[model samples]
Target chain A: AQTVTQSQPEMSVQEAETVTLSCTYDTSESDYYLFWYKQPPSRQMILVIRQEAYKQQNATENRFSVNFQKAAKSFSLKISDSQLGDAAMYFCAYRSAVRYQGGSEKLVFGKGMKLTVNP
Target chain B: AAGVIQSPRHLIKEKRETATLKCYPIPRHDTVYWYQQGPGQDPQFLISFYEKMQSDKGSIPDRFSAQQFSDYHSELNMSSLELGDSALYFCASTQGWGRANEQFFGPGTRLTVL
Candidate 1:
């Protein structure tokens, strides 16, 4: 079974400072997808960024970027100029490229890293 | 943009009772997935459906059953609920079956089994 690991259980970042949340996964499949999702106090889960395993280039979405190291099986999320709104529980999820059992390409998520923005 | 919708944002139920949760997928979407998130825990995949058919399953309990309707809507029926069943149940939808499609998640229904 594939598993995602997030070593940091809690992290604090100064407002306007930069922060990185680390993630690692165990998978033998060559083709897959990695994603970072943010769950705010409202409990709504929002997609932050995504990276394709086949792509060598890292994925960036405005202030959110990912450092994807395929060989190391590491996918880290970097938030530049972190804002108070960035304070949330962030999750790293893994998705397989192929659909198993007709449509079970569900995401495998890590335990999550709680990010606190200090003003 | 419109997003997935789940009914009964909060539900309180007694142990061994039955509860049903409904999900309305986004227009034109053909796939729906169910997930359970315990307190302070990551969401766990429960099951998935494609075109109103059971496509895959995960750690769903035998007491819980779900199905996707022809209209792309879905429902999770929980019978003989236990206290451990209390959690936030989320419904996500995606277009098509394969490929790296981004899933749109619903606000989720919070179930409190007493």
Candidate 2:
């Protein structure tokens, strides 16, 4: 079983500044994928970014990027130019690279980190 | 592109009562997944369906059942509900066989068991 861990339960970031949320996972499989999801007060789960375990280069989406250190089993999310709307609960999730039954694979998620962006 | 749609944005039930939640996937999406998130908790995978067939199972309780229809819509049925069953239920969908769990989630349905 794969388990994702987000050590920081809460994070505070000033507007226009940068914040890094830490996440680690324990997985025996060599092939897998890592992801970060944002849940706002609306309770919608939004995809922040994703990183493939095989890719050495980190993934970046607009102001969101990730520092994926595969060997250390760590995948951290970096939010640059943080805005007030960035306040939410961030989760780190893990998925197997292998596709199962041609669809709908499940994700194992961390407890989540609450990020607070203040002006 | 339209995202997954979960109907009955909120539902309130009592202990031992039954409830049903529905999900409509994005157009042409063949894979659908269900997740449950308790208050102040991360989402947990429940089950998934592909092509109207059960594809994968997770930590879903035995009292819960789900299935996809030919129209690509899915329904989750919960029986003998308990207070602990109160949570936000989210439905997600993905595209083809090669999809690497790039699922787009729905707005979610909040279920409250009284």
Candidate 3:
């Protein structure tokens, strides 16, 4: 079984500053995927960024990026030049690699961290 | 391209009644997923479908059921609505079954059971 944990329940950052959301996971499988999702007040879950275990390079999407530490089982999301639009509930998720049996690839998500971008 | 679309943006149902939510995936998407989101909680995976076949189901109850149509649209049905079932339901679509692929989500349907 796989599990994702977000230790920070809430985070705040001033506009134009940077913020980092912590995430950790427990998985025995070597090959897997990590993801960060953002949910705004509208309650829509949006994909922020993704990281593949096989690739050491962290994923970056404009101001959003991930610091993936495979050995430490840590995958943290960093939002640079934070804007008010960045305020939302962020979630960390994990999915196992594809198996020969064609098993289900369901995402196991963390509790979520509420990010507040102060002006 | 248009993202995932879910019908009945808001629904109000009475206890013991049945409710059905609809979702239309983006064209050419092979996988569709359903999730439930309560207030102040992360979205939880309910089920997923690929090529009209149920690929996975999470820790959902028997009253919760889903079906995928040939057009790639999916429907989530609740046999007996309960207060606890009141939450936001999201439908998502992905290009493939690979874990590394990103899933696009719909705006979601807010279900209120009284």
Candidate 4:
């Protein structure tokens, strides 16, 4: 069994500033994938970024990036130059790399952190 | 690029009533996944299909049933609905069974039980 943990329930940052949301997971599998997703007021789940456990290089997508510490079981999201539109509930998710029963693995998600960007 | 499609963006059903949700995966995607999101809670995996066959099961209730058709579209049938079942139902799709492929999520169907 695998579980993702987001310790901080909520966080706020001033516009144009940067903020980091922390996440950790428990998994015995060596090969797995981690992701960060954002849910806005519309309730749409949007993928922010993803990282593979086998890759040491962090994943970056424009202003969004991940600091993946595999040995520490930590994967955190860094939002640089935050904007009002970035205010949303962010979730950290995990998935195993091994295919089970001929199907792709299911995602295990954290409780989510509410991010508020104050103007 | 085409994205995953889910119909009846909003549904209102009474307790003990039944509802059916539909999902149309992006063209060429062979896998479909279903998830449930409660109010102010993280999404939980319910079930998944691969190539029209049941692949994985999660916390889905026995009163609920789902299947993927030959066309790659999937339907989730819920019976004896309860207040707890009134949540956002999301359908996600992926092109293959690869380990690193990102799952594209649908807009999700919001089912409200009264």
Candidate 5:
């Protein structure tokens, strides 16, 4: 069984500043994927960024990027130049590279952390 | 690019009532996934379909069943619903079972049980 952990229940950052949300996971598999998802008040789940375990290089999407430490089993999201629109519930998720009984892999998510960007 | 579409963005049902939620995946997407998120909680995987076949199951309750259609659309049927079933239902899709393909999510359906 795999599990994701987001220790921070809530975090706040001033607009135009930077904030890093920490996440850790427990998985025996060496190959996997890590992801960050954002859910706004509209209740819509949006993919923020993804990091492949095989790729040591971090993944970045504009202001959103991930610091993936495979050996440490840590994947954290860093938001630079934060904006008010970034205020949302952020989730750290994990997916196995290996299939399950011929079934597709499903995402294992963390409890989630609320990110508040203050203007 | 068109994103996943979930119909009846908001639904209100009473206890023990039956509810059906629909999901239309992005064009050419062969995989569909369903997840449930309770108030102030993270989304939990319920089920998944690949090529219109059940590929995976998660924490879904026995009262809930889902299937993918020939058109790659999926429907989740919930029966004997409980107040606890009231939550946001999300539908996500991916093109293939690739190692790095990310699941694109829909706006989700908010089901409220009264």
Candidate 6:
């Protein structure tokens, strides 16, 4: 079973600064995918960025990027030039590349981290 | 292009009553998923449907059931609603059931059981 963990329950960053949300996972599979999702006050889930285990290069989406350390089983999301719109609950998720008999891809998510960007 | 659309943005039902939520996946998408979001918690996977068949079921009770039609529309039915079942239900769609692809989500339907 794959499990994702977000050690930081809450994080805060000033506007125009940077903030990194920590995430770790436990999985025996060598190939998989890691993702960061954001849920704002409206309670809508939005994808932030994704990192493929096979790619050593981290994934970057504008100001959002990921630092994926395969050896340490760590995948952290870094939000540069944070803005007030970045305030939301962020979740780290893991999905195994190996599919089961059902052919369904299930996402294992962490407890989540609440990010607050102060003006 | 339409993303994912969920009906009944908000619903209130009495205990033991049945509630059904609807979802319409984006055109051409082949997979549909249902998730539950509780207060102060991350969304938890409830079930996934592909090719009009149930592919997987999450750690939910037996009272929860889902069905997908030929048009790729899906419905979630809660047989006996409980207070614990009160939460936001989100629907998502993907082009395929691949771990590498990203899933698009809907705004979600909030259900309240009193």
DockQ of each: 0.73, 0.69, 0.72, 0.65, 0.63, 0.64
TM-score of chain A of each: 0.95, 0.94, 0.96, 0.95, 0.95, 0.94
RMSD of each: 1.4, 1.7, 1.3, 1.5, 1.5, 1.5
Give candidate 6's error at residue B91 in angstroms. 0.8
- Per-structure clash totals for the candidates: 0, 0, 0, 0, 0, 0
- How do the predictions measure up, each by TM-score? 0.98, 0.96, 0.96, 0.97, 0.96, 0.96
Full candidate order by lDDT, most accurate first: 1, 4, 5, 2, 3, 6
Clashing residue pairs, backbone N/CA/C < 3 A, model 5: none
iRMSD computed for candidate 1: 1.9
Q: Please give, for residues A2-108, the per-residue lDDT of candidate 6 as tens digits.
A: 78999999999999999999999998788888999999999888999989888999999999999999999999999999999999999999877644333337788
Instruction: Tell me the TM-score of model 5.
Output: 0.96
lDDT, candidate 3, B1-114, per-residue tens? 788999999999999999999999998988999999887777889999989999999977899999999999999999789999999999999877764667889999999999
DockQ of 2: 0.69
Runs off by more than 4 Å, candidate 3: A99-102
Q: Native contacts retained by model 3, as a fraction?
A: 0.85
TM-score of the second chain, cand. 5: 0.98
Report the C-alpha lDDT of model 1 over A25-117, residue by residue, as the tens digit. Answer: 999788889999999999999999999899999999999999999999999999999999999999999988875323249899999999999
* Pairs in clash, predicted candidate 1: none
lDDT per residue for candidate 2 within B31-87, as digits (tens), equals 899999999999999998889988889889999999999989999999999999999
Scored by TM-score, the top model is: 1
Output the chain A TM-score of model 3.
0.96
Q: Write the per-residue lDDT of candidate 3 for residues A1-119, one digit (tens) a residue.
A: 88899999999999999999999999888888899999888888888999989899999999999999999999999999999999999999988877633456888899999999999
lDDT of 4 at B90: 99
Judge candidate 1 at residue A63 and give its lDDT.
96
Docking class of 2: medium
Q: Which 10 successive residues of model 6 chain A have the least lDDT summed? A: A95-104
Candidate 1 lDDT, B1-114, residue by residue in tens? 889999989999999999999999999999999999999999999999989999889999999999999899999999999999999999999998886789999999999998
Candidate 4 lDDT tens digits, B1-114 = 899999989999999999999999999999999999999999999999989998889999999999999999999999999999989999999977754688999999999999
